[model samples]
Target: MSGEWQHGLLGCFDNFTLCLISWLVPCYQFGKNAEAVGESCLICGLGFLVPVVDIFLAIHIRGKIRESKGIQGSLIGDLLYWCFCPLCSLVQEAQEVGGAPQAISMGRE
Candidate 1:
């Protein structure tokens, strides 16, 4: 695995649907990202409803993702991303872990 994010923080528009979802329902996107890394989707999704806990959860899950995927990043960077551009960060994480690769089919034909 590459020691880098599959999608850039500002590359949310790379997948318009995911970007829109991340914008329209941030909690859901966050939950999905958390779930991808074995965290409780409902707990994380509901945690996003809170103010302070949301940032903490985001940072925690981002760290889990980075560790699982071998992506290079720091907690401070994760904090900055979640604090400044949460939607973009959510979209990036979703793209990195949620979707199947373009060359493969994850769904039944």
Candidate 2:
């Protein structure tokens, strides 16, 4: 696996609207990232409600995204990323999973 994140964390200005949304409603942004990678939005969203567990869950979701997309990253990196800058991490995942510029559709076809 040798892929990289499509967008940088601090490059939120690339999508100012998403940056605002991410800053305002991080859980919602995280939920969108989770759904994009085929995780349960409700479950992931709920995880963020708890402070301690949210870090672990965020790392788990990031790992899922990395694995699914063949992106290169480590557990420590994920932990640190979520620990220090969760909003940027969420936005990065959203970009990686192609959910940044669009709304996450919950309805099944």
Candidate 3:
């Protein structure tokens, strides 16, 4: 694959990884599963693999992106979202700015 493709592909995976890590980073939340941190990692990590949930997750951690330093470490997942899921982003922006999403049906035109 091209470099851009690789960036996007790996980027999304990295993003998911970061989101999972951030969600589980509080440490206390994984108290019961501390014995199996590996498995806990996988579970929290897998949560970001889903569609919309993952995107919101990325947004959730976005604030930490700056505090954690450059992408990767704590911010990789957030940055990866920039590579993936543009439609959702646009709609979100529209809703936030426009207040509500007005459906524009082709049939109407």
Best by TM-score: 1
Provide the global lDDT of candidate 3 against the true structure. 0.34
Better structure of 1 and 2 per lDDT: 1
Sort the candidates on TM-score, descending order.
1, 2, 3
lDDT of 1 by residue, 1-109 (tens): 9999988889988888778888898888888888889999999999999999999999999999999999998999999998998888888899999642244568898
Instruction: Name the lDDT value of residue 88 in candidate 3.
Output: 35
TM-score of each: 0.88, 0.85, 0.27
Clashes of each: 0, 0, 1
Rate residue 66 of model 3 by lDDT.
27
Candidate 2: lDDT of 102? 61
Once fitted onto the true fold, the runs of candidate 2 whose alpha carbons sit more than 4 angstroms away are 101-109
Looking at model 2, the pairs that clash are none
Better of 1 and 3 by TM-score: 1
Which candidate has the top score in lDDT? Answer: 1
Give one digit per residue, the lDDT tens place, for model 2 in 33-59: 889888888888888889888988899
